[model samples]
Target: MVITEERIEQALRTLAPVMRRTPMVASRALSDSCGHDVWLKCENLQRTGSFKPRGAYLRIAGLSDEQRARGVVAASAGNHAQGVAWSATTLGIASRVYMPIGASLPKIAATRAYGAEVVLEGEYIDESLTAAHVYAEETGAELIHPFDHEDIVTGQATVGVEICDQMPAVGTVLVPLGGGGLLAGVATAIKLRRPEVRVIGVQAAEAAAWPASLDAGAPVKLATMNTMADGIAVAMPGAVPFAQVSELVDEVVTVSEDAISRALLLLLERAKLIVEPAGATAVAALMEHTDLRLDGQVCAVLSGGNVDPLLLTHITTHGLQAAGRYLTVSVNVPDRPGGLSALLELLRDQGASVVDVIHSRVAGELRLGEVQVTVSLETRGPEHQVALRRALVDAGYLAGE
Candidate 1:
């Protein structure tokens, strides 16, 4: 059955007690940048740190007693695994979750903590999905497709319902696209209720499937998918969600990895929200898409917050460098100990905070008595970085980028 507005409403009411009504707050930074009122739908704070549980609960609840007894199996990168494990645990049903071997450790632990048998299989989500299907067939367990089913779409539509109720003047809504489940559900609800509201979908440039699929006029599978935004890195769009998105979504755009990192850093610093790369795609699109003529209130859905700590650290460092807040330069100096101390003094006088200093005596590029010293500094911005570099150069030091 196709997911309709009426079905979405019913699903929202049914899942209300089980799900959190995540906040939709105004984003002054985004609004100022885009020259329009921008709101953030913080589903990153939803139960299980994503919107997956809503669909998982509803899908599991719809199963018959026999089906429940037979148990359920699902494949996911992380979020959906936790969602299904949590739902199955709550319903007193057996569940087994297959996840990519490289999935986040915290997510794997959380899924297991929710009382589901965790199976680490394959290198990508599609491989894990294949394992889940095989296990389902061998054990007669119910297979829960992540984003393809009408019930799952109906459950995800609740996010759209809440967005409409929270921001009545919303002129545009941006959602991160994976297999297109969330976008399909949100678009169906918003467009059906407020036909004038424009719904746009955002995808990571590296793993985007929607643009090519839309161009082909059908669901097309990508040969390979690689992206740091693993949460929304589906190699292909789901058939059901593809149909819904094709009919309802107004536009689709892709954002680069640098844009995604910047968006995550922006959200964490300005909004005080820790969002995953996939969750920040909408915000990234808003920052990158200068052609959008948004006038009235616009909402960007922050879809999930299940990022690994190591990845967060790397992204934060990259963002700092990209913003010119961090600067690194190599300089030729005297081989004596006082030479290093003199350079540090100069940096301190220049108001540059030294993060790290590396001294090398190698003769690759240095003169007979010269040594190469690499300095990492934290500066205010690009201007400060330029000023510091000029000061170093004026001091008779050969500085390199």
Candidate 2:
């Protein structure tokens, strides 16, 4: 059955005590940037730091007494595993989760903390899910998919219901799509309530399957999916979710890796919020949308906040490079100490902060007595970077043209 309004309402009631309704926080910075009244549905604050718990709780709540006794099994990259583990434990039911080997450490640890048996299996979420399905069939444990099921979609639709209640003025909803469960549910709710409001789905360009799936009107698996937004890195949309997304979703947009990193940096630095790459994908769409028509009261669902600390660090550095604040320059100077000192003095005068200095006496086509010195500097922008290079050149150091 399709996700109905009544089903979503019941799911909300079932999950009321277990799930956080989360906040709809206004972002002046985002609004000013996009020229829209932007509000973030911070599902990153939901139980398990993701909206996955809503669906998982509702799915577990649907299990019969017999199924509950047999326990439940699920597979996910990270967020969905934690969601299922937490929900099963809350209901006093035993749970087992199979996760990809590449799943984040924080997610695996969180799943373990929720009183579930964690199984690290396979290379990607699909493989893990396949293993879980086999285990469930062999052991008779109930299978709770991260998406694809009606109960899960209905549970995810609760977000749409809460958004309507919290912000009746919301005219558009932007959501990140992996298997499309969240988007399907939200689309059903908004379409049923106010068919006028639009539902837009954002996917990582590097790992986009929905675009082709929607065009073909079927779920097509990808041979590979390479994206930093691991949360939405599904190789193919689910059968059930594909139907709903193809039918209800108004548009499916893709965001580049660079755009996602930039959005994550913006959310962290300017909004003071920690959003994973997948969670920030919707905001990335808002920033990079070629069409200027989506500028009204827009709500972007931040689906999860489970980024690894290492990934966050990389995203920050990459964002700096993307924004032109960081630059690398190669300078040819005499292989002497004082020669490097003179170049440093000019850089100091140019107001550029030196992040790293690598001097090599024997590499990259250097002259007999001259060494190649690469200076990585932090500058304000193109202008500051230009001035820094100019100052270095005016002093007779051969900075790369």
Candidate 3:
């Protein structure tokens, strides 16, 4: 079924009082970097910490009384699970949500807290989806697919409607593509209202299926998917959303894992926003792709913020490395107590904050009289890292990789 602007407007009316009309805030940092008037669609701050609730609520609300009585079931890595759980609870419908075994702990906890029975199964979203389908068939529960149905797409299109209404001069819109629901819905809505606006979809390079599927003229499945952005790590594109995307979306692009990490860090540090890796893909694409003609008002949707704290630390470290703000260096010094101390002094003089220090004398590369002192330091940026390394080498110390 085709999702129309009218249906999106209807969904907006239904969700207006309940859903948060997430802000579209100007991002001066991104604007300067991308050479465009950049704005952030902060759906990360939406209820349930993602845009999933918009569709999930609409899907559950449209169910018949008998269907609602039988309950609802869904499968997601994290965001959608919380969305379905929260929506079902609000509508007084019982919910069972299947999530991957390695799904974020906080998301799983939040889903259960939303009054849904949470089932941990499989290693990825597809496997969890399989288990959900089995449960739905056995219990006669209404299965709410995360991004494939017309109701879900129509619901998500409300984001585009808001963008058009909020930022009338917006010339380009970048949305992260997972199973393509957000991209399909947003593109359809925006194009229907303002056909001149360019709609672009961004995907994680590691788990991207849309590019291949678009090339093949059908939904294509990946053999394996691996990425830090577990939220957008769908192995296959949904047929329903794919059709909408193929028709409405102007372009689809991919961003590297490092790019995503850097984008997340940028949002955290510069924008003072905690954004998940998947949600940062649109920004990542804009940052990495200098060829994009984003001269006019451009908006990148920050789709979700349901990141686990532990994972956030790892991603932050990765981002620091990607940005050249963190450095690890090893220097050979005399095998003495003061040897490591001397190197630490040098690092301090170089304006590098030492995070970790390790001293070893039994290394194969080190001589009998020499100890290897490895220091992990945090620096200002690439120039500071370069200066620190140069100073270490000029100090007559063997600074090896």
Candidate 4:
């Protein structure tokens, strides 16, 4: 049951024809910010738009013809469901998937497109998983777990092999920890090949499982986890992955939602890579640390790219706000219509791009016959924001930051 380098190598060879050998690209921005040689393992570009396909394909491929005929089933929020569905379709096996009702529309559509019967039930992953288990028992379908099985782990190990081949000088590998299939397999392969290399696993601080689980020396379940990184927002750690991670991984860290969002923005703006919140977690950890800076050649695995369009927009907007590139100012002006026009003209003269404006005369505690004006504007950076604020102050109006 042990995952060794040879087993990983074998899986890589078997999966080569079907799966993509995703790129390992250097990041100049990450390098400049972290003061180290940084490379991105772009598993976001893998088949299924996530690394899930590697394990899913390997697990189904190992099944016998009878097992395949009996069909396979799985429970997931998104990525794993798509993985199993796509793998089953390619292997000509009937598959069924149980997913939370709130699962992303694109993922649900993609899973159905891959020829799996999609059952939407439950408020969270555990509920969907419970339904999937009952269905499997009644229908006599082979259950394919997302991260807990041996074949799935072996399949995920291929990533480590590829990383070693692509970046031989790598001393540290940062992995996003979810249910742990990816980390367990990748850690096993890395330790088996180059025991000297350090494997660092990261989790979203809001939905983190490893911190408490590792402390208790067993897998612990969360009552509820709220985080934007839905991909790694696992409520509990897997039994198999916990064992492997405990033994092989050198460190486990947690990053805040703000940190993850900032990292996501950095990837999009600086690295020019589109990554989901889960995918940006590792880089978030590396960026969050003020004391423990990663040295030498470091690789951060971008786990997936399948982020909701709305969430992506929110993340980008939030990033701009966090960076002081977007600002909102409130000022009191005369009730006359020309007052609003004059204020806007002053903003234009100061080189600020207005995004939104609101004028209120009916509400709030204000001087009689005076109107409240709230303006939202976009600036180039902190300097521009400062310039706009100074100009507003010099123009004889009270402005709030």
Total backbone clashes of candidate 4, pairs 3 or more residues apart or in separate chains: 0
lDDT of 2 by residue, 1-401 (tens): 37777887788789888788899999898898878899999999998889998889899988899999999999988899889999999999999999989788988899999889999999878789899999999999999999989999988998988888888988889999998999998888888887888899999998999888888879988878899999999888999888888888889899998889888888888888899999999999988885745835999999999888988999989878876789998888888769888888888888889999998987878779998889998989878877877777777775457
Cα-based lDDT for every prediction = 0.91, 0.88, 0.91, 0.89
lDDT of 1 by residue, 1-401 (tens): 27876788789788978899999878899999898999999999998899999888999999999999999999998999999999999999999999999888999999999989999999888889999999999999999989999999988999999999999999999999999989999998898889899999999999999999999999998888778899999999999999999988899999988889889999999999999999999999999889975658899999999989998999888778877788998888888769889999999999999899888998476788888899999988889988888898889885445
> What would the per-residue lDDT of candidate 3 be over residues 65-150, giving only the tens digit for each residue?
99999999999988999999999999999999999998878999999999899999998788899999999999999999999999
Off by over 4 Å in 2: 290-292, 386-401
Error of 2 at 84 (Å): 0.5
Residue 250 CA error for candidate 1 (Å)? 1.0
Q: List, residue by residue over 316-346, the lDDT tens digit for candidate 4.
A: 8887787777899998888876988989999
Task: Write down the worst ten-residue block by lDDT for model 1.
Answer: 392-401
The estimated TM-scores of all candidates read 0.96, 0.96, 0.97, 0.94
Cα-lDDT of candidate 2: 0.88
Which model, 1 or 2, shows the larger lDDT? Answer: 1
By lDDT, is 3 or 4 better? 3
Best by TM-score: 3
Error of 2 at 68 (Å): 0.5
